[model samples]
Each structure stands twice: as C-alpha cells, then as structure tokens.
Target: MSSLRLVPGTPDAVLSALTAVLDGRGTPFAPVPADPAAAARVRQAAAPDEPLEHDCAVVLTTSGSSGEPKGVLLSRDALIASATATHDRLGGPGQWLLPMKPYFVGGLQILTRSVVAGLAPVVAGDSFTEAARRLTGPRRYTAMVPTQLARYLDTDLDALRSFDAIIIGGAATPAPLKARSAEAGVTAIPAYGMTETGSGCVYAGEPLDGTSVALDDGRILIKGTTLFSGYRLRPELTAEVLRDGWFRTQDRGEFMDGRLRVIGRVDDVVISGGVNVTLPTVQARLLEHPRVKDAVVLGVPDTEWGTRVVAFVIGDPGRDELRDHVAETLPRTWAPRAVIRLDALPMLASGKIDRQRLLEELR
Candidate 1:
C-alpha cells in the first residue's frame, strides 16, 4: 500500500507537484498551506504515512466547519472533469487568477483550470488590478469567497469588472453584495459545492455538465464525474456519504424555475420560543439591509428558548432594525433574539465562515 504524501511547499513548488499528479506522473498527495497555524489543522487531518487509495490525485483536508476535520480524496479524472466543465460553462478555457489560498479546493481548482486551459495562473497579491493586468488570455476568470468579493465591490469596480466571470463560493453571499455586483456590471456567479465534490460543481444555481443534482426528500444529492472517490483512510465515514454513486449533502434545497435554491443545511433550523427559525433564512434577511456587510445567524443553547437565535454581524445595522428586517419577509418569530456586532466575521483558510470560532466567541 502506498502512503499518502503531504506537500507544504510554496505555490510554485506545489503547482509543480500538482501538475505532475494531474498528469499521472506523480504519487497521490495533499497540498497544505504554508502558514503554520492554518496548515496545522490540515496536518492533523492528513495522515501522510497512511495508505492511499489507488488513482487518488489529491487529498483535500476539510476543517468540517462543525465536526472534526477529514481528508477528502479526489481523483485526477474528477479534478480534470470539473475544470474542463467549468471552462465549458464559462464559454471556453481561459487564464485564472488565484486570489484565495492555494491549498483549498476553491483555489486549487483555479490552478487545475489553468492547467486544463494551458495557461499559467496569475496570483492576485493584495491588488486586484495588478493581477488583472497579468492576465494574457482573451477570457479571464477568478474565484472568491463572499467576503473578498464584498470588499472588492466597495474598493475596486474597474478591477472587478476586468474578469469575464467571478465564481463566488465558500459561503452564502450577502444579498446586498449581489445587487451591488449586478448594478456595477460585474458578473458574479454564485457557486455551490464542497471539497468532496472536487470544488464547485454547481455554478449559479445549475449543475455543471457531467454533474447531476437531485433532491432526496428535500435534501441535496449530487453525483457525477466530478465526485470524490472517498475519504482518505476512513472508509466507514466515506460509506456514510457516498452511496450508489450519489453523495448526500447536508443541505436542503428546492428547485424553482429550473434553478436550484439552497434552503440552508438540514440541521440549520432551531426551535426558539416554540418556533422553528431557519438560521440561514434569518441570516439572508439580515444581509439584505444596505448597511449590513456580512452576517452569520446561529442558534445557541438556552434554557428558556431551548435554542436562542443570535445574529453576529459586521456593519452598522442596529438590533431593532435588523429584527424588523427579518419580520418583513419571514415570520416575526424568526428574528434573532441577540445581536452581536463584530469588526469582521471569522474566516477559515478555505474562505468559509469559521462557525466554530464564532461559537467560541459566544462562550
């Protein structure tokens, strides 16, 4: 049995190894960030010496937002399929900009897409304009989390409009940002997928060409060539999710007008004051306010309410105003009971909202 290898090298170095792996010339490996703290969680989940699965191209370590971290094993074929389909969906192959960390699937897919497109990726180092200037391809693209895109929309419109398409993944984007992007002539594509699906298989509410999205009792079920092979050295856990070629997602969504509408995770609902409050719904409503930049709605333990709904936000929206905002579209009981304002939302290396850290803040 061949052991899994770990690559904690610089971007250029990791890209070299990744190129070989995708070409079937190198062994199976996991690319981790160079930052000690960010890379530490990946190190704990990646069993470098453990036996690797056959034909495994990359093992992406996930911090599991809520649960323990796990290594998601993806094959070379799946990664290539996802990249190629992404190019097809976006009109054609083009150069990509790597704005996020190089290790996670969101950033890793940018590198993979570049390799598939036969173009070198331009790394966006602090300045979006500098990176946009480096793009030599006729068609240009980049992927960003909601937070990064929100910042760019406020600071740089010319740079944001330079790209043909900007894939927004990592977390639920604020409604205000979407309106601003559209009004500013920036084509921001909302993406959905996790490391287990070889990055975003569904872009802007539709499944990519080789991917299929179905509803399993209102739960999201995806299957296709872009799917991960299994979890690294954890077949039992892998069996729990991947069944009969379909990967069960924790999210519950519905399709209206042929486009998938994600309705938050299955466990996203909490009973507060004898009412079912969907956290994402409340969070989405909070984000619609023009003054609100970003928001995260969560349910905490409570003796009276069973689970007290709280809103941790970054912006100038007051408690009463936010509560009134939710009551406008949603039930009045769905409003968050407590409001906690923060300078910025906690983010993980993968560009996902660090829910664990946010929960820690409440403690």
Candidate 2:
C-alpha cells in the first residue's frame, strides 16, 4: 500500500515534495493551505489513516467549486506519459517558467516536464515580468489562464513575448484575447483538458501525441495514457466519467477544419424565457464590444424567465449598450437581462472566475 503525506500548499514545499514523489523516492503527497478551515477539509479528504492504492503517486484536490473536495489519483506512469507527450508535441523540452502554484495539475505538469527534460524550472518571482526576464533558455514555455494572459498583455507585453510559447487554458479564451495575443508576437496556444486527463492533452485545437479526442453528442470525450486512475474513494463518480478507458468530459466541443474547438461547459447553458442560451456564445459577443474589457455571463433565478441571463463586467459599460451589442449577432433573448459592474471579478487561486462565488452574490 502507498503512504500519504500532507504538506503546506506553498509552491516551494509542494514542488519539493512533488519532486520526491515523481522520482519514486517518497510517499504520495497532498497539499493543504495553512488556514484552519481549509487545512481541516484537506486533512479529512487526504484520509491520512487510510492506505492508498499501490499505484497511486499523487493525490490532488479538486477546486471543489460545486461541492466537497475530491482527491484525484494519478500514477507515476501516467505522469511520465503526459510529460513525454508534451515534450514530443512541443518539439523538445528546454526550460519552463513556472508562474502558477503547484497544487493544480497544470503547474504540477510544468514541474514534472522540467524534471523529465533534466532541467530545473525557473519559478516566477514576485512579479511575472521580473520572473520572465530572469528566464534563460533556447526554448522556453509557460502556461496561463485567460485572466493572467490578459494582465500580461496589458502590463508586460515584453514578458509575454520573452517565452517561445505560452499556453492558455482553464477557461474559454475570448476571440479578442487570442487575436491580441497573436498581434503582440505571442505564440499563444489555446489548450483544452482538465485534471482527469493529466493536464492539457490538446494544444491549439490539435491533440498531442498519445492523445485522442472524440465528440459524443457534442460533449468532448478523451482517451489517452495521461488519464488519471480515478477519483479517490469515489468509485461511482469515476464509473460515470471513465467508461472503457475513455473519460467523458463535461465540456461541449466541435470539430472545425479537423481540429477540436471547445464550446463551453455542458452545464453553462441556461433557459431564459424558455429559450436556450449558451453563455459562451453571449460572452464571445460581449468581448467583441470595445467598451467591455472582461465579462462573465451567468444565469440567475427568475420567476418570469426560468433563468435570467446576467452579465458581470469589469469595465464601465451601460447594460443596454452591451445587451444591444450581443443582440446584434445573437437572438434578442440571448442578450443579458441585467449587468453588474465590478472593479474586478472574484478569481480562484488558479486565475479562474469563481462562478460559485458569483452565484452566491446573486443570492
């Protein structure tokens, strides 16, 4: 049986312990924040008293945006497969700039890839720009979510262009953001995948080596050696997703020019006035508007409409004007019924919009 070790969630500790695990020199580890409440939850989920499956090499906690924490079980073989495939797809591994925390799969993969390439990753300093300037490599790569990418574009275009490639994932990439990234001399590759698939198996709408993507009723299904073993102690949930080695992702996707294009989460759709509205579709339109900087489209409870479309915007834009912008291309019902202006949207540690927090705001 494998043993479990709990450590502080700080990047340094997490990376040191992760290196030991990946090198097969120590027990599987789980990261817990220093906060009492968060640490308690992580401790309970880690189940220190229970022995893990022999093949399990790491126990990663999910963001748990919807509910309780879940520990994802990933094996060393799977991690090696992912590292190999990533290097093969990227033309070879050189050096990686680590800008994200190691608790998540993406950050963990960065560390793992560096180890596989026999090079140490350059952890970003206090500022992303400063850390980027410190990097030295013939081929350097890094990953960022949409929010971080936007911040870099606005604040440090030089830092963004310093890397050979920057991968964006964790949420949908707006069309405007992609275009802006390209215009700024950034080789930004929009990736698609999740923790269960062991990070991004698809880069820039193409599957990496050893990764296969298929569409099931518009939902994305992934088959690859990088897939996780299962959810810790959640056999039923694992059974629901992993069927015959193909993991059923909850995100909807489509094929354009023989490349996979992720639409949005399956549950992101809402019925407003008895008409279905895809939040991504509405959000893409909102992003096209010049006045709107960043926006999130969500559904709120409504009596007249099954669910009312609401938009939270970062910039100063009139509700009517943004609504009309969306209506110009989409159906009138798809336009946001209400808009809330915020100085900045609540973000998770991984730089994703905290959708559950936004729902609580409505409540």
Candidate 3:
C-alpha cells in the first residue's frame, strides 16, 4: 500500500486525498495531524471507507451567486465519459494546456483529460507568455473563457494558432470573437453546460455524443450519464432541478437546425412594452459590433413598461451608433432603451459573468 498523508475531518483534506487516490498515486493515507488537539484527534481517527477507483476526480462547488453553494460529486467514470465524448468529437486528445485555474470544473476537466490521455498538462503561471511557451510544439488543445480568447486574439494570433482546438465556455462567446478565432485557424468550439453536467455537454451548438437535450417550457433540459447525482445536502434543491432522469438546467434554450442555442436564463428574460426581451440574445448581437469588446443586457423597471431594456457595454462606441446597429439587426423595440458604458464587467469566481452583481449595479 502506498503511504499518503491525510488530514482528518476537513473537507478539503478529504477531497485532496480522494483526488490523489483516484489518480492512482497512492493508498493507505497517513494524514498529517492538525495543530489543534481536538481537530488532531478527529483527523487521526477519520478515514473514508469509500475507495477511490476512477481516473482523476474532484468535487465542484456551484457558484451559488443566487443562493448557497453546493458540492457536486463526480467520479472518474463520469469525467472520462465527458472527456471521451470531447476527444471523439475533436478527433484526438492532443497536448493540453490550461490558462484557467485547476480548482474549477472546467480547469479540473482539462487535467483529468490530460491524466486520462496520459499527457501532462502545461499550466500557466500568472502570464500567457508561459502558456504560449508550452504551446511551442505542434497542434495542442486548450480551454479558455471568451474574455481570455479575446485578449489572445488582440495580442497573440500566432500563439492562438498553435492550438488544435480551443474550447470556449464559462460564458457566451461573442459572435465577433467566434468569427475572428475561426478565421485565425484556432478551431474554437463554443461550449455550454455547467458543474452539474460535468462541464460541457454542448459543443459548437450541438449536443455531444451520448447527450440528449430538450426544452421544457423553454427551460433547457439535459439527460445524460454525465449529469451529477444531485446537490450535496440539498435534497429539495436537487428535486427542483432534476426530473424524470433529466437535469432541468436553469438556462433557456431553443432548437435550431438540430442544435441547441442557449438564449439566456429563464428568469433573465423580461417584458418591455409588452414584448419579451432575452438579454443574452441581445447581448450576443451587441457583441457582434466591431468596436464592442463585451456587452451585457439587463432589465430595469419602468412605469410605461413592466421593465425596460438596459445595456451595459465595455467598448468605446457612440450610443447612437450602437442603437442604430441594434436596429439593423434586431427589432427596434428590442433595442436597449438605455445604454451605459462600463469600465469592466464583474466576474464570478468561476469566471462567469456575475449576473446578480450586474443586476445590483443596475438597481
């Protein structure tokens, strides 16, 4: 038996040990005692009976921006299934590099796939130059958020080309970014899904192999082996999201050309002047503008309408020009009634746009 250190009752310690054991590194954990006498006693006696047998595994905590964060259990089998589907879709698991942190599900998935594919993942330390150095060889695969991809596109087109495929997720990929990245031979695949679904189930607007998607009253629903068992210690919440073996994703989506296109959150849609406006769809169109770097659309209260469309933008462009641009693309009524410029958009710890904070700022 391989001797390994384990700290008794702490969740992080137990989780770390589980990751190590599942990675096939060692067994018969020897946990280092904590300084506190009471905690030390608990650690000395605490040992998980469940044996870790999968490839590499980690528990992901939900962002909990709307409520409390809940841990989702994931096994090696589920992770491998996700990776296998991705590899099958993308051809093969090439050399992997990650600019994202390893703690989140997206970051952890990259490492898990690297371990499963028997390739060491190159991790960037505080700089893209270090990550670019690791991409020196032939074709490589990496996962990045849209913001990171945009920065790379603005600065390092050559480094971006080194990637065989760049999986863009964690938020909607602006149309301009998608078009630019594809033109540069980056093979960017815009993905959609969450921690409960083991990262991404939809790639480039299509559901992955072994994944099924449906819309219940406009709410996106996913059914697959990759779905997590349930939220830890939140049976009521679990029951709310899961139904009939399908996970009812809070995102609202529509089917077009046999592909699922996520519009926005069901609750994010608002009625303005008796017309329903989907913020994400409007934001997508706003992002298509050449001068716009990032954009977010939200609903603000109004007496004339139940809610009025408001847009917050990061790029420096004339409000009239943006309004005209939206008029040309979307319905004039759907165009934002008010436009505000923001220096930067708030982001959650998971690298997703903080919708709650945006709403708060709007209020």
lDDT value, residue 152 of candidate 3: 83
lDDT of 2 by residue, 1-363 (tens): 777888888777877887888888967888777768767777776676788853677777776754677788888888889888888887788788888877778888888888888777888877888888767776888988888899889888988898878888777788999999998899898888777888889998999888999999999999989999888777899899999989998889999999999898899899989999999899888888888898999988899998999998888879989888898999998999999888888987656788888877776
User: CA shift at 161, candidate 2, in angstroms?
Assistant: 0.9
Better of 2 and 3 by TM-score: 2
Model 1: runs farther than 4 Å from truth? none
Clashing pairs in 1: none
Model 1 lDDT at residue 117: 89
Question: Candidate 3 residues 1-363, lDDT tens each?
Answer: 222234442324544554565576634342332446433332333223434222224445565655555556565567778888888888877667877755467876776667667666677666665676776434478888888888888777887786778898888787787888878787789999888888988998898898899988998999987787665445688789988989998788889998888887878878999998877778888888888888888888899888989888998887788888988978888888888888999986568878688877765
What are the clashing pairs of model 3?
A: 4-30, 6-30, 6-31, 8-43
**Would you list the C-alpha lDDT of every candidate in the order shown?**
0.87, 0.84, 0.73
User: For residues 1-363, what per-residue lDDT tens digits would candidate 1 score against the true structure?
Assistant: 656778874567668878998887888778877788757777777778767765588888875786888888888999999999999999999999999777888888999998888899998887888888899998999999988898888787898998899999987766777888999999999999989898998987899999999999999999999999888778898899999999999999999899998899999989998898889888888888888877899999999989999999989888999999999999989988889999998888778888888888888
Ranking by lDDT: 1, 2, 3
Query: What is the number of backbone collisions in each predicted candidate, taken in the order shown?
Result: 0, 0, 4
TM-scores of the models, in the order given: 0.96, 0.96, 0.82
Candidate 2: list runs displaced more than 4 Å.
none
